[model samples]
Target: MPLSRVVNDPEALTITVVADFPVPVERLWNAYADPRQLERFWGPPEYPAKFTRHDLFPGGRSHYVMTGPEGDKAPGFWEVLAVDPGKSFEVRDGFADEAGVENTAMPSMRMVFTFEATEGGSRVTTVTHFGSTEQLEQLLAMGMDEGMRSAIGQIDDVLADLASFAAERATEAHILSDSQVRVTRVVRGSVEQVWRAHHDADLMKRWLLGPDGWTMTVCEIATKVGDTYRYCWEPEGEGEGFGFDGVLLESVPPRRAVTTEHMTGTDYPSTTNQMTLTPVDGGTLLSIVITYPSAEVRDMVLATGMTDGMETSYARLERDVLVGS
Candidate 1:
């Protein structure tokens, strides 16, 4: 992928570049809205970015550390000045301490991105202004220009990988019939990793838990067809909250499966689930078609934040298990 065209004026102490992404404006905006997306292109290929703290609100400082091959962390902070969702944002960029606090000792720059629609996609014009010639020299000496170009180069790959997943996230779960609720997410990982993450009890506990406090306490899976499996979840301290047991109707290794689910405590009727995993261009498209007893029961369950929890759980799955894997 080609890096964004760079223009640097040492005399003016400014760097200006406009990048045109083939993806939609939302995709570009999400690179900043989502930390995981931002980190993918936050730095060059050698120095992978890992965000420690990210808050996009005005006056909130987002900090991330880019780790180099030598195991050194080059921390950077963005002091957000303004945010207009899907349109533009401005921030002060500077080096930061290991603790994520900005380092006043180093030179800083004011950076902004103005997003506008275009025939092909959206055009993002990024402008950076330095305080003085010395400050500009300071950044140039640190290869700021080259690093910025390298960082921007990775945006296309990152967005392409997330296009399917982002599309699914933007859409609400569709009620296919009177009894079924379907949710799909295209996650970035090999079929093997995706299969393992979903089937492995220990790995499921790592990211399957919704929010933070709740956890999947018990995970019992029968590997073969016609066998039964059960999963239990409860609050860390509180007593049991919810669980489900299922008998495997069919199994196709990492590709597809059908199961019958029975609720443990809830009055809702049993559910049958068909999990289909189709290998897409980037990864696997995971579709979970779950059938409840009736539309009333499905609606009632959806009202209890099950859809939101599922979205959160899938996001955690992508962030914790997929992506760079």
Candidate 2:
């Protein structure tokens, strides 16, 4: 119902859909920039989406799976091509296998999403360019048009619910899949400051402490890919100490980072952590997606009140490090 028009042009080999919303351009733009909001309406009603990774910057990639009523899943990915914040972005959209690798046999398309201020409120136009007429026709026959309309119809509800994703909210964890969990928080700091807080040894020792009475005894910062970082924590008076060491897998500066984390002195399997930061209305949105070795491991970690501890640390970060700086 939000769609004003849907055009399939054979000569141009493009499918364009225009939709209008009764919200400001920023509100509409945030829905896509933030993965939590994006997953809510990225898929049709029958196939709800779960975004495991969503990086809105150029050269970044997003991976999501749409689960059907019968528990079947269809995975897809997007390679971000360009971005003009609050205005437009282009991506190479394609189908993917269970591993999130693109299926070359299937056709992929270039998609351009444009957002603009309208007389009423705002408008969004999506132009999907196919490689050939055959590919476009193939996609249309696969219910692409109806699927898009169904997906956009759910955006109204998502936009109306502002409190759910508010910046003041505490840290929360979402189960992205059997082996993946996404933890999110909006800290009262710029993206650069938040990124630095995680990297600078002194800055980290000040706020990365959870709860109280615990001191970070060791903080070895990882400055580049392939570098290994270690962090150890000990109680002020008495308790068993703990530590974690990880190798930096990827680093994109103030925007994103990926690392392999392992508990020190433990033989347990390692976990891959992917963190992304985006500037939102109130502050910077920090999203970390952790891929565990198994569902049991993921559940066990979450059952240990991981999010609660994370919330405590984030609060300390804002109160101690970012408030004035």
Candidate 3:
């Protein structure tokens, strides 16, 4: 006999299960959409199976087979009714025979999977709808709820593993204008050494932004008032790079330098970066003041933990130059 439904009323027995997993939305969606990933955890222990001909888009079809205790195989088919990548998907379920044809034992069911992004990860809800009350009750009698609970448990394990993997791939996306981080550090190095690290092409490459492939086609700095320079930053690879076109507002070689970093590809407003290097008792006190266009930008920067990113970058610089030198 086919598996019985868990609900009795078509309207009253809508079984909805919501589960939270510590995996990013993209990772969670990929686990369901990708066949290789789906094969790892979509079945119960009693009937281990793999999806066949699985397709994730609307109007697509996926087939699967389950092996019973005596090695008997039961096949099934799912026709995707709607797909919203990384968000939701809906499908109709049917039984299939050994010959890979649809069977008449069970009525078709509408199954919907929805994903909602949470603070740390995502919440996934699966809702299954039966055609009639009798079908729902029939499924429940067959322990369908327990089977679903098992299936969802497998999903939880898969998502936990994926959370670790997704953490490494997280990069902040350019969204609002007011999100930029300002970081300050005190360096136990001479002002000249610190200034050189910021201005010298070789030193800049070693510590700051790039191996950006652009030949520095033009890096001319006046170090003094009334002199301006422009660097035609170009991307090294096939695509166009984020280019900055601005004048040096102030430059005092070993003491202070300020520039407007205006990049074409970034949504961030042009930033005025004023870096001051002062010779203290033993070393140099480096003060960096980054002024954004507005408070919103400042909040954005704080929200993304850009401060932490800056501290990390600066720590790397300290190790590479202060300690290594």
Q: How accurate locally is residue 250 in candidate 2, as Cα lDDT from 0 to 100?
A: 99
- Candidate 2: stretches off by over 4 Å: none
Angstrom error of the Cα, residue 135, model 2: value is 0.6
Q: Per-residue lDDT tens digits of candidate 1, residues 145-211? A: 8888888888888778864355345214656456766666666677678888989888899888877
| TM-score head-to-head 2 vs 3, winner | 2
Worst 10 residues of 1 by lDDT: 163-172
- In order of appearance, the predictions have TM-scores of 0.54, 0.98, 0.47
Where does model 1 exceed 4 Å of error?
Answer: 2-4, 163-325
Question: Which stretches in model 3 have alpha-carbon errors above 4 Å?
Answer: 1-11, 160-325
- For candidate 2, list the clashing residue pairs, or say none: none
lDDT of 2 by residue, 196-218 (tens): 99999999999888888899999
Residue 112 accuracy (lDDT) in model 1: 89
**lDDT of all predictions:** 0.76, 0.94, 0.62
Candidate No. with top lDDT: 2
